[model samples]
Target chain A: MSARDRILGAIRESLGSTPRDTAAIAAEAAALLADPDAIRPELAGPSLTESFAAKAWGLGTTLDTVADMAEVPAAVSRYLAQYGLGPGLAMQQAPELTGLDWSALAPHDTVAPDEPVALGLARHGIAESGSLVIHSAPDNPILLGFLPLHHILVLERRRMLPHLEDYAALLGREDGIPRNAILITGPSGTTDIEGSYVRGAHGPGFLHVILVGDEE
Target chain B: MSAPAPQAGFKARAAAAIADPTLKIAIDRTTGTAERKRAAAVAAFSEFEAARARGKAIKDHVIAHLDHYLETFERNATAAGAKVHWAASDAEACAIVVRICREADAKLVTRSKSMLGEEIGLPHALADAGIERAETDLAEHIIQLAGERPSHIVWPAMHRTREQVAELFAEGHHPPPTAFDPATMVQSARHELRTKFLSADVGISGANFLVADTGATCTVTNEGNAELTTTPPRVHIVTAGIEKLVPSTAHAFALLRLLVRSATGGELTQYTTFHCGPKRPGDADGPEEMHIVLVDNGRSRMLKDEFREMLRCIRCGACMNHCVVYRQIGGHAYGGVYPGPMGAVLTPVLAGLERSRDLPSACTMNGRCAEVCPVQIPLPTLLRAWRGRSWRERLEPSGLRYGIGLWAAVARRPRLYRFASGAGVRLLRRLGKGGWISRLPLAGGWTGSRDFPKPAGRTFMELYRAEQSGKGGPS
Candidate 1:
């Protein structure tokens, strides 16, 4: 017998069942897919944006609040200046960030192999863990998030969810999950050497989130 | 295949670990920080208990109906252009991975940390097939350079000091530095592994959770090496145990809630990427082909046994961090890929009781492992179960058996027990010097470590009888 057949057979014999009802299995799986039960953690702040920023800051992610999308370049420039970095930034060709006035920041269309900064747009933000949800597509490439010294994520405050469960609910509404939907909490780090945490292990050393269009 | 015979038994290994002051200090510092951080992380979640309950329930439900979920995962994964392979044993799994790499004409392979990969000896298998593999995770890289197996599940190089790591880097890489700064060492490894990541033909990683609903494989990592290992190569291979299957993304998140907090005391890992499948037709980055190798090894048998709860482990490493015995001896003393409280119970199940019979006895039965276990695995109960099995099979030494038998016989009769205890105490008092017994026959094991306290002048029964008779008041 094939490995699959033998393995499944062993599992069946152990479970003491043979060929469960397909319809029943499908119904169970579908029901779970539709509305999965989860325990959502309550946040400290009154609004999702504040809660997200507070939690994100705790995780070592720098945060900047912008009143509108047009101010993103200025925010990015200010952040770059604060870090004593020059004005060259790599970014994806997403519609949300395409027409911005990035002249001040000298935004590049393609991310360099050793790009010091990269900007990307977040599809959603999770409040409980302060994670940015980025969906991989042609417009928003996945590498923009990982292959830079600094990662600047532009997110709309309205897209922030209360917890991971709410993000799952949002995915349920979509036709199909994307090829890659990453939930990144902070910059890369490791405690491998004698349990000392050092940031920027094969990913961005710093994470900066730009929250735009707040509730007020 | 059975695990290779340990270089030495648990007693000898643990003795050496205890003697090594450096190992003790490293283990103390690392596990101490891990425990403190885990406490704070769990406390941050007001619903930690509820989340743990739901996580356990989800895992139990999935394990009960695993066949259905695996089938669903295979179907959905295939639909998303990922090839799924099943392996009933370690050899088959390694062979499948080798075949895939060979077909892809892979020369340099980059790998993220995978305990299952270690269990199957994937690196050895690939080496036999003439493929060079680079371990990208910093801890794994250190161990690989040092030519060692992982001591701890989460912290593979917990046994190594920063000085040792600096030495290994100097020996293994070019332009070695003189200082032993962790930050500099990490930056050096990042630069070295970055070349491998860009040039590798295939990337291999392990999945923390496999979502059946979307055919996505999720990996949680603080270092983000798994992301690099998965994205840069033309082909990405995920070697996961069959038990890693969860019903939905929501269930995955529920378990993730406990996994990160319990493992490293982080709210979430730096990166929790869910790779649905291979890159879509216009995707700018991602592997063109993806493969999920579901390894059974000995898990299927475990699923049917009384020790099935062992399968619910999320590899959090909390049990070891809080375990008294594990805290003293470290992971190398266990003489297995996995160590600590979880290893004590699991190594026996996977490797068989005859070879690893001493593991279950290594625990102090403090029950701390169960308390901190995110999935609520009754670890002490499982350890005791193993001991019972070993006793029934007479796996213990005949000397021990006869000794216990004698004790049981004497304890069944109160008068004989009282007489024996009284006589033994009096004799010990004679032999003991300055209120401490420096040595004793048949107890050299206990006395070898420290001096044994002398027994009181009288047995409890003697004092009790005197008090009852209203004789000179008992002290």
Candidate 2:
């Protein structure tokens, strides 16, 4: 009779025996279709919220390349200064994050690992899905991805791959990042709770991005 | 040492697979999302075409010289204190793995996503051996929990919804309903598998690529499960096809760069760990021993066959993702662990066509699969080749054979064939509605979902003949 009725009829016909359980499944489907945030929240069960990828872009920032590394510490400093992550917060190293002056922001007393990163910045990024590709290597600390509540990433413009097929050109791609190159698109997110998404569940709560242009 | 065959057929299973509303929702949304992301991912590459060609060329080169690379890989892996085992068939592979599991007294095994394992039905063997093998990959674990094979390669449990997953988790072990939070699921899984990982006597992983130069193996995963799955275990084993090996790290990198973007629309996964050997000297947190089981398993046979180009496949599944047939029918319809365009060719070759005949004929030869294949495996051509094999093997249906034979007899003489076609068209047109053959004997399949454009009153040759001879006295 109606779209709902048709769907219900379809479900009834499909389920044969498992009618009620199928009803619950149908309702969940309707709810998921009805609103995504509801699903996101249910995914988190309204208990634990995880970060969305967009938030990760917001918390920490990015620059186009390592040449623009000079501007990154200042950007990271300003972002971190507001939050006071400077004096005591720990900094994890990424291979791409190497050559950046960490001392400028915080002189000493930094923790190495966090249950969730406060600030996580990726060393390499592929522009295709706005994915951040991180390889676990010595300089590129694996802790940066998992630890900290806030995360900031410095992505080189040159490193951004347009397609998944473009990685054939990377040096030592076979070896991969010696440590861990975490290709992160967004902040840590979880839709696992009840179907609703919660950001910053296990990883960074915030993701700030700084897209470094060629001239900038 | 095998589980009974899954009773349901492809269409039945696929229909059942999409029955879960949440799962359907999840599949539609996730696949839709992946498609969009893939579009964006491809858009960034100005040289996508060139990359495809180059990657295919590299893979082709490797497959061509596979024997050389395999030998190199063996020597290097042996040099690195890794023992290499070769299995000529799925049974042999399983036998080798079970023997290793037995020898090591490995009561428990944690495995990362190994489709090859699914192909060989490894879990049943492990079950028969009474060795617990836990699927470590989150998606694989979900399928493992369901006691079902993976429907999609890249996202193995691509068809499951959180609620369905919750229900699965609710089964057997219930602390509460399954959490939908991807993170919680991760944690729940981590919580559940934490003990498994810690206590696992052995770890088994499938390599994304095997580096011959360094005797290294790589497994890529989004979660850190792969790392824990291998490092914490006492004995770590890697299983893969011989073609998985490349000459050097450079070649492996070449494959890796394309793997994530092509499969997951990411530049790379979070964890792409390389398991070289057991805890080497000072390596505190790693496996005590490492062994690589190189499974030939019908591959070398294919190497000398016409379908040898299929060996270059890196299992990236772009062809699967892009195939319209696959998108409509879904993966399970291929009736194998491997599905889509690649599966159509591979299923028959690897498993024998008598059991896998439906695969080759299942396709419409749309050519989209070949367009998307990273290694440029001419999937349709390979499907045709398989069709030929089936024909030669007398697997073709009698009706189809008779019809084709009749058509061929008529086609031998162009005049009779044209007359027959033209006369048939005219007769059909006479009975047709509004110039289109909306229905016909055995032709309803063509008109079921789409319209068949009306043929002209006369054939092109007839028109040409009249025009050339001026028989109609046209101005």
Candidate 3:
């Protein structure tokens, strides 16, 4: 079962016995237990979203240039065309990516976000637990980042929230918002053997970054 | 002429580590909880960065003037009635320890988790001397019972699952328990070992941080087992890597903030112990004879090298827990007692490259370990540096060198780089179908289990060139 389904199932198990609305509890649990690997760095029409690299210092680096929608589309297409993200690619189109022209960079195969597409771009309003907040929806699937081999992501520079407060604020404004959210940062990596790192063990082998501007 | 004995070779032992699922689950849960706890602890400490910065600075200063601090520590510890011995090599260190053990006619020795003990192969050496060495840490005890070495630093038996424990516990005890209730197994082991702890002639421990100013050795343990080990023995022997010493208790206080949070994600270990020497004239309980054995054993060499920063480690195991590689494959896979990021940096230094050559080059250098390190050990940088040095020394595998050399050569030139990228994509496209490639050579391990997307027809540079030429992608 998918992490989303499992999380939903657990909440349903917990809330089914409750007197209050069960769906609300399930939605909340979905965000708490979202699949970590399904995050994506998407290249929609005008937003060039990429994955976050866990630099020694942090992911809070500021990229000031306000890029054009055309640049975003062009960047996405170029990565897809050269890197090849057609069949099993992910474009982790989250709520932050809702308004972009996703069809502009749509692959010929019409694959879902979880298919390991070219990239997935997600913006978490707050990331305290070494994760990125990605609110889910029909258009913004959470599975895109979790199951894929090479998960990429793009973060809006100004939208890099410190904690979880602003994340809730963003969710407060939306209705029936897919109730599921995810947090991703640096590709899933490990160092068990006296501290040697091996990439692509459980999650994406590669994670790329393309910071979008939110000030504009 | 033939394959070397498994006991004499580290690589052989490392291979054996992964085959045991019990060790693997213990490693997983241990490092998993440690990573989680560290994250939570850091979140709790609003002044964490300040604390880390101060701790790192204090330790670095102490290291810079180590000669002075060592002299001061020796003088003070000697005055406080603690005998100090400096051994430049493991043999010298081992000889000194064995001599002390023999003097006491020690039949049993209880030890806490000291990576130094593993490095010296002391337990085996003790066994050879007709002395029995018992590991006091819960995880260490489990690994000892199963006859295995530690894979993870914090939770020595982090790789083992609960069920495995039931089996191991059932093996030794006659009235063997019915099932492997984790708590029960722990309790039974505690009961079995409690007599040994009080009866042991000598107790040995590793210092988390040794304070020079107060001539005190501090150990942080959640179980407080190290304290028990030190207190009950007639002769207390403290073995530490040369790097464990800090200039003062004040310095220790600074490092403690990073140590607890980085190792196990607690505000503090359940117990924080500082031992100066044997029981004072009026003390209720303490060792009769105190010995602080300073083991330089590869540490003096590490200090002068490019990777000296690794010496700053406080054994927090943050690198192990948050480590992606350690999480899936576990620690024994690395083939050293250190395991995780610290192990990667340390194993090559202590064991030398020939036996542990694969360690440094194996890392992705994501810098997460360095980022979270309490003492600011530049783990990935050192790993990368070790890879570079290994080649200079001709210690690396020829195949890896050739492959990396070819990639490096191609990476230096744009035309060739693009050509290689294009060729790689073409080959991938030709062979990749149904979204997977089952038996691709050189990358078979990845493709055998999962799928590798055929590279897209474009390269990053090609698209950049197209955009520069005012030509959009071909429709």
Pick the DockQ winner. Answer: 1
Mind giving the per-residue lDDT tens digits that candidate 1 earns over B97-136?
A: 9999999999999999999999888999999999999999
Compose the digit string of candidate 2's lDDT tens values, residues B164-255.
77777767344543555465555565556656766899988888888776677878766556666776677888888877877655455556
Q: State the fnat of candidate 3 relative to the true structure.
A: 0.00
TM-score, cand. 3 vs. native: 0.65
Error of 2 at A19 (Å): 68
Q: Mark the 10 consecutive residues where model 2 chain B has the least summed lDDT.
A: B1-10
Give a tens-digit lDDT track for model 1, residues A66-154.
99999999999999999999988888898778888876778878876688999999889988788999988877777788879999999
Model 3 spans with C-alpha error above 4 angstroms: A1-216, B1-27, B470-475
- lDDT (Cα, 0-100) at A57 in candidate 3: 14
Q: State the C-alpha lDDT per candidate.
A: 0.88, 0.63, 0.62
Better of 1 and 2 by DockQ: 1
- Chain A TM-scores, candidates in order: 0.90, 0.56, 0.51
lDDT of candidate model 3 versus the reference: 0.62
- Residue B314 lDDT, candidate 3, scale 0-100: 81
Q: Is candidate 1 or candidate 2 better by TM-score?
A: 1
lDDT by residue for model 3 over B293-330, one digit each (tens)?
Answer: 87776665555666667767888778877777676567
Predictions: Cα RMSD each: 2.9, 15.3, 25.3
Query: Model 3 chain B: which ten-residue window has the lowest total lDDT?
Result: B1-10
